[model samples]
Target: MGIRLCIGSVNPSKVRGVVSAFQSYFPVSDVRAVKVETGLPPQPIGLDVIVRGAELRARLAMSGDCDFSTGVEAGFYRFGSTYFDVEAAYVVSRELGESLGFSPSFPVPPWFVDEILSGRFRELEEIVDSLYKTENIGEKTGFISLLTRHVVVRSELSRLATLMALTKILNRELYEKGALR
Candidate 1:
């Protein structure tokens, strides 16, 4: 039977990234997507929170019978007066292994950071939508795309992170204890 690789999120960019990563790593695998709650804020903040969200989703989504599963989560991080975007991915396998991977970060507009830090608005997507005059852009190009000038899209970042997580799964000898930590 072909490996059934499931994704814990149905966001278009996430779906594309997970599917692409699995296809590239194991061409014969069957990839599928499902909407899973990360148990995090609608829009998470801080790197740790985002990574935990991905790991939680991956663990929950992989509970059923499946060869592999993954979850990708993105969030904004603040340092001093600067804010940036980051992504994390978690992958779980039936062999009782899991791993985490991170995406390259890009700085967010200072003004937007100011608004978010002001505590009036917590969801970055809403702010982005209002400023860009768009509707739910997070599922499409994503802030990553906009910030990077499309040099690398959201899917690309997610895919890179997925590939990184897959490393521990594929190389069990290097990580016998566990990967998801």
Candidate 2:
């Protein structure tokens, strides 16, 4: 039987990214996006919180129904006086193996970061949608693409992060030998 892949998000971009990344390694039999709560603020503002949030979602989304589960989260990182956009990815297996990966960060507007940190903005996605008068831009290029002029898209970034997070499973021996346990 082909592999069954599940992602802990309903966002079409995230689901597609996960599926695409795993497809290179396996012939996926079934791919599904399950909505799961990430017990974190809507707009997580730090590296630790963002990674933890994704791990939580991946672990929770296993639900014993899929061979592999993945979680993808996008957040901002504060370094000195600048805030950069980051993508965090987590993958889990029902057998208790897991891995984490991150994508490159790009600088965001200082004022926008200030507004978010000050709690004046609910979330980055909302800000992007409101400012550009766009609806659900996230499933496509997203705010990053608009800012970068499509040099990269959210789905592309997510796919790369997902691939990195699968390293443990890709090696197989590391996990099978109980090195991670």
Candidate 3:
């Protein structure tokens, strides 16, 4: 039987990314999108929180029928005085347990971070939308697409993160032998 997968979000970009990533590795028989709560703030901060959010979503999306479930979340983390935006992907399977992966980080302006921290904005997308006069930017090209001049998009980020998370599953023998541990 082909692989059956479920994703914990209804976001178009995320769904496309996860589906594309899985298709690259396996013949996915069925793909389902479910709206699952992350139980996290609109804008998560810190690496742990971001990863936890992904895992939570993945776990919530898991079902008896699907072979695997996935969740993807984006947030900011600090390095020195700079805040960088990053996306986390978590995959859960009955046999393989769980795997986590992250996308490349990009620095966001300090002022933008300040605005988010100050509670002036609920999320970075909101601020970006206001600035660019674009609505629901996260569902479209994403802020990164604008920053990189359309070279990289939100779906690409999700795809990269999902691929990374699937590394262990793709190389099951190596992982079973603790190659990546």
TM-score of each: 0.87, 0.91, 0.95
Q: Distance from true position, residue 66, model 3, in Å?
A: 0.8
* lDDT over C-alpha atoms for residue 136 of model 1: 75
Best by lDDT: 3
Model 2 lDDT on a 0 to 1 scale: 0.85
- Local accuracy of candidate 3 as per-residue lDDT tens digits, 3-107: 999999989999999999999988999999999987799999999999999999898999999899999999999999999999999999888777999888999
Write the residue-wise lDDT of candidate 1 on 99-152 in tens digits. Answer: 998888788888776777687567788898888887777788787767768777
Give the lowest summed-lDDT range of ten residues in model 3: 171-180
User: How large is the C-alpha RMSD of every model relative to the true structure?
Assistant: 3.4, 2.6, 1.8
Candidate 2 lDDT, 52-108, residue by residue in tens: 888987877777679899999988898998898888999998764789988778898
Query: Each model's C-alpha lDDT?
Result: 0.80, 0.85, 0.92
State how far residue 68 of model 2 sits from its true place (Å).
Answer: 0.4
Ranking by lDDT: 3, 2, 1
lDDT, candidate 2, at 11: 92
Judging by TM-score against the true structure, name the best candidate: 3
